[model samples]
Each structure stands twice: as C-alpha cells, then as structure tokens.
Target: MDSELAAASQWATESNAAVFIRLKTESGVVQAMDSEEGDEEENEEGEGADVIEFHPEFTYPIYGEHERIFGYKGLSINLNYAAGSLATYFNIKYTKRIEQMESTSTVALKADDIDTPMRQILADSVCATQSEFAQQVVHDTRVFRPSGRKVHEYAGRSSQTEQLRYEIYSSSFNDTESAKYHERMQAFVLFFIEGAQFIDTSDERWHVYTVFERLDMNGQTSYSLVGFSTVYNFYCWPDRKRARISQFLVLPPFQGQGHGSALYSYIHAMVLGNSDYADLSVEDPSEAFDDMRDRNDMRYLLKHNAFAHIKGARVEQSAISELQHTHKLSRRQMTRCIEMALLKMIKSVKSQEFGEFRLFVKRRIYAQNMDLLQALDPDERKHKVAESFASVVDGYRRVLSLL
Candidate 1:
C-alpha cells in the first residue's frame, strides 16, 4: 500500500506547465506551438508576423494556491482564440488519468476527478471539442465596428511611410452591445492580470475602452483586438466623480510595441478633458504598469510650462496644488513626478543639487513610514530611511531611461 501511494505522486504535474494558451488568426499570421518542455518560442517572419508562446504567471486562481493538477499524467490543456474577434477554443487532453476508485472485497478508495474544476472556471460558450474548435468560423471584423463613440486614433510608434493605424473606442456597461463584448473579453483579465476579478456589469458606473488594430490588406480592411481597459466611475460629492482604472491588458503577442502607452494616454486624456472627473486613479497597478504610468505621467508634466522650470529638491506646495486641481493628479502622484523631474535635472552625484535631492527623498520616506520607523531606535530609523531613498533613486533612474 505504501509503494502504491508513492507511485501516485508522479502523476501530479504543475498546472502552469500543463496548460497551453494560443491565438490563431484566419490569415495564419499568428501561431503558437505547444511543447511538453514548456520552452518559450516566437516565430517572426516580418512585422506582426509572429506569435509568442507563453505560460500563466499565476495559476493559483484556477488550481488553488499550490497550483498543482493531480490524477493525471501527460496532461495538456490548450486555450486557443481567434485573433481578431477573440472567439475562444478550449481543449483538454491527457495520456493517462488515474481511476476514480479502487475496490476490494471489503474496502474502497476513491480519488478526486479532474476536468470538473476547470469546466467550472472557463467560459460556458467556448468550443466544446478540439474538432469543433479546428473548424472555427472567424468573425467578420471588417464590418464589426466597435459599439460606442469613437474617441481617439493614432499612428504606431515605429511608423514613418506606412503608418500603422489604431483606433480606440469608449462605451459604458449600460450599452447592451458593448456589454456582450465585455463578457467575451473579461476572461483575459483572469488569465493575465494578477488578483483580478470580473466586475459587476449591472452597475451603470462601469465603463470600458477597447483598442483594435486596423489592417488594410489587399483591398480588404479588418480590425484585430489588441488590448482593452476598464474603468469605474465613483461619485465623489454632489457633482464630482473619480475615474479609477480597474483593469488594463495588452494581449501577449501584441505587447511591448507601445499599445499599453497608447491605451493609457487615451484614458488619461478623457479624464483631463471631462470636468466631471475630479481625479484619475488606478486600482492595484502591477510593477510593470506602475513603471509605464510613471513614464507617461512625467512626460506630460515636462511638456507643460508649470513643471518645466521645476529643478529643486524641495517639493513646492503651490505647484502640487496646481497639479492636483488642473491635471487631476493625486498628491502622491504629483510628489513622485516632482522627484523624477528633479532627478532628470541632476548633472552629477557630488553636486550640492544631488545632495539636496537625496535629503528631500529621505525626509519624505521618513514621514510616510513614521509610525513604523518610530518603533525602531533613532539610529535604525535613519538607516531604514537611507535604504528606502537609495531604492527610490534606482527606480527613478530606470523609469527615466525609458523616456
């Protein structure tokens, strides 16, 4: 019995490794291959001709905290999508599944069944079988104009002669047409964003923004879903409101090409243009998103005349107030932007300006963590503040380089 129990252990596989996700396009322009070894691969023929294979960063949301799938050997779960419309195709396969029960003359042992847990997690309308998914009918994205008011359009970052065009559309959850698309698109937040949950769509305060790539090929035009963002409007007072960005994601294959920056800039512009939005905020932004936000925010400040002359280590209260009221920037965000602007002006570390900047950062750090720092000895508090200042400087330098 001991030997038999030990043998069962080998059947368990890491859920992250066993799962394979892919995007298949009708033009055959994008393809992601699955492998038992789980190595990353990208097949690029030219611009937008590659599909990068990836695994889930966190599967705890699907398979519990340990993220382990038991009772199976050689398991492969594929979650495929049609590129443009994002129609889903889900398929699961396994070489050997442990029998659910072991019976004897007088004793019986039962093991847990697989597939039941996953079926409940995935979307109900996904393709049921591999064969059905293989015959997927691509939606007519050419005529599929996004349902909402067309807001902003721009050229791709690397475009010069052949400008790659992209458009952004905004809609509210109240729109029935847009809500249907949101239901199909929300699954991406689960797969990509950490600690993300589906929002309550019944609420009228929820809004969505979608990005699509406009492809004009051989006298035909089509739009491909590149990424999207969700925002919730909270009433602040009698008339004011706060717009908080809840979820932001750029598809894996379409990432690192300035789509995230474009999406964020469009959302930021909407907030700045609208008088109803008192301020803009984000809900639990990840590190990568934070870095992007920092870069974008600083760039905006630098372009404006108010922040162009900011050079001192000391953060000015008047300037902070101006940013808060005029640009809808929060106090914390304005302070960070001021620090980054000061860092950009520094010529050398040995200069008096650099020394003042370090001191300024240390004071801010100490004030923020005063309650925790007061618990420690005076000498230790100073040491902790210095460590935090060093970390902040390192991060600022990294974000500045991206600009």
Candidate 2:
C-alpha cells in the first residue's frame, strides 16, 4: 500500500497531471460507473468509472527532506501548510505491524515516489483522512517475524501469559551464531523507531531477553523471531551488582501483543525475585518506554497493600525509598513514579495548589546541590531556585502527558 501510494504520487508529479485509482473485484472485474455517461449497460458491466484523486504521506519515512531524489534535491519546502497538523498523519504506527489487516479501516488518499519493500508495507493500514494521526492506526492482531531463527527457548514458570505458545530466553554472548539473527532484527527499529541506537551486545555484562513465536512447518515446530531487549549489568556506586536496561525494541509488527511488556516484566521480575540479590534500573528510557515503566512500576508498587495506607499522604523521599526497597526499583525510577502519582493529588491547580507541588519536586532536585546552592549569594540562590523549579515543572508536565 505504501509503495502503491508512492507510485501514484510520483506518476502524477511526472506527468503534471492527476492520478486516479480503479478497484478490481475478486473475479478480476473493475467495478464502477460515471453518472454523466447515463448508460445503464455501463453501470451493469462493472467497467471502471469512479475515479479517486491520489495523495500520500510517509507513514514510515525513510528519507529526510534534504536528501537527493529523482527530479528533486535539498528540501522541498511546502511552508504554505501547517506542519503541526501533519504530525499525527505521519508518526510511526503505534499498532504492531505483525498483524497487517484492520477490517474496519478506510484508505489514505496520498502517494509518494519512494520504493518501499513488501515487508515494510502495512497493507492493512488505512488512511481515512489526510489528517489522521499515527496513534489512530486502529486495533489489529499485531504479529512479527523476528527475521531471526529461534536460538534459545525457555518457559515462564509463573507469568501472565504462561498458557501462550511461545518461549522467552535470557542469553549471553557465549552463543555467537544465534546472536547474528538478533543483529538482523535491529534494522527494523531503525525505520520504525526514532532515536534508536545499537549497543555493544558483546560485553559479558550484557544480557539479552528474547521472545519467539512457536511455528509449525512441515510437521515440525520452529520458532520465528519476535521481540527482544538488552540489559547491561552496571556497578552500583558502592556495590558491583546492579543491572540497567539499555536498548529495547519491539519490531513494528510484533507490537500490540503485549510482547514488549512481557519481555520487560519478565526481566524486571527476575531482578526483583532473584536469589543472588542484585538491583535493577533502566539506563535512559524514551518517552514510550517511560510510559511503560510508569504503568508497570505503579502496578508492582500497588501489590504491597501498604500503598493504600499512604495513597493520600505527601510523597516524600523516605516513601520513595521504601517503595524502591519493596519493589526493587532504582531510586530514580521510584522518584519518577511518585511524581506521576503526585499529579493525581491535584485537587486543583490554583496558585497555592500548584506551587506546593512545585516546591515539593524542586526540594528533591535541589537536595543534592544544597551545598552549591548555599554557597551562592542571596540573589544567585533565588535565581537558582527559580530556574530549578521551572526545569522540574517542565519535566513533570512531560511525564503527565505520558500518564
């Protein structure tokens, strides 16, 4: 669909004319009739007549405006239109690409010249309107072909998806051969995900968690590549036994199946319920990942039943620490979760109400820098406080948006 749309667009541009489409039925008959013709035979024969205009947008943009293309070079700036409104129309699809068809979808009326591969095309994706946002890629049975063969498989002794037919494994660098397939899967993220980076999976401290869908071919059971995440064991400030999640990607097609959450939770649960007692943390999380962490962490924290007792209490550093200890969350993660919960405490955002929350959050951000803050002159201290407060409030807003 992406390529077909692009072709229609390119053809229109080249000919200095408009592009139209004809729909073919199951029996390979083009169906339609033009009212202006006023011929009953034309209507009954199913000869093409209804012509639709063609237009296309980059649902999966692989190129930048400045890149060179046939008959075009540098940016093709179309500033006469609003860019903000186009944002939702072209964000990476939130629905996993694995399951490719949405039964109740209309089509997008756009096209481009870019040649997209079959695997990259979302045949089921609909373009109901030119203004449709990426998140609106309606519900579908998302699936993914990891492109990598199953190198390892293990069952979850206790998990939410225990009855499902699939396997997840935590493998290290020792298996050099299967690691290559894992590497092949990274390419998918390059196109569908923004700011995705590859890491050194060779380090001994690096552990990979992978999920594979079990398939049957020629009467034999095999596993297809699905989704994966990477975690690196980082040394604690004073201890040497802490792990931090580094890179995470659920191939576009494999999303919406809870695979990403399952992968994250399985590893997190291991850190929380491990016998050796190592701490868990995330290195640097993207907005989407952070939202996932917020939901997962909050759920885990709520399990203690102690959370209910302090649901209405002011969130303090001590409470953050207690939740961390109870749920195996890093100090940073617990603080973030608390900030999200604190937002729920807003009875109103009137002057005093909002200021108290601001002071509370800034108090935490400035706690470690108090010595530096104290050494400053009075004016400088006030300036620093104002700046710090503003910064924390901005971040709090972003978290709230995610929540």
Q: What is the C-alpha RMSD of each candidate to the true structure, in Å?
A: 5.3, 15.1
**In terms of TM-score, which candidate is strongest?**
1
lDDT of 2 by residue, 1-403 (tens): 6755554333222211111112222111122223325332222223332211122222223344332233221212110101111111111211111122232145543333443431242222333332232122121112223333344444422334333256676777667634654454444344445555556666778777777655433343333345677788776656546878877776544567667777787778888777443567876687778767766666666555536545543666687778777777788887766765666556676756566777777777678588999899989887898898776656656655643
Evaluate model 2: give its TM-score: 0.52
The per-prediction tally of clashing pairs is 0, 15
Taking all chains together, each candidate's TM-score versus the true structure is 0.85, 0.52
Per-residue lDDT for 27-63 in model 1, tens only?
A: 4422222221232322222323433345676677778
**RMSD (Cα, Å) of candidate 2?**
15.1
Q: How accurate locally, in lDDT, is each candidate?
A: 0.75, 0.50
Task: Return the lDDT, model 2, position 151.
Answer: 41
Q: Which lDDT value does model 2 have at 65?
A: 34
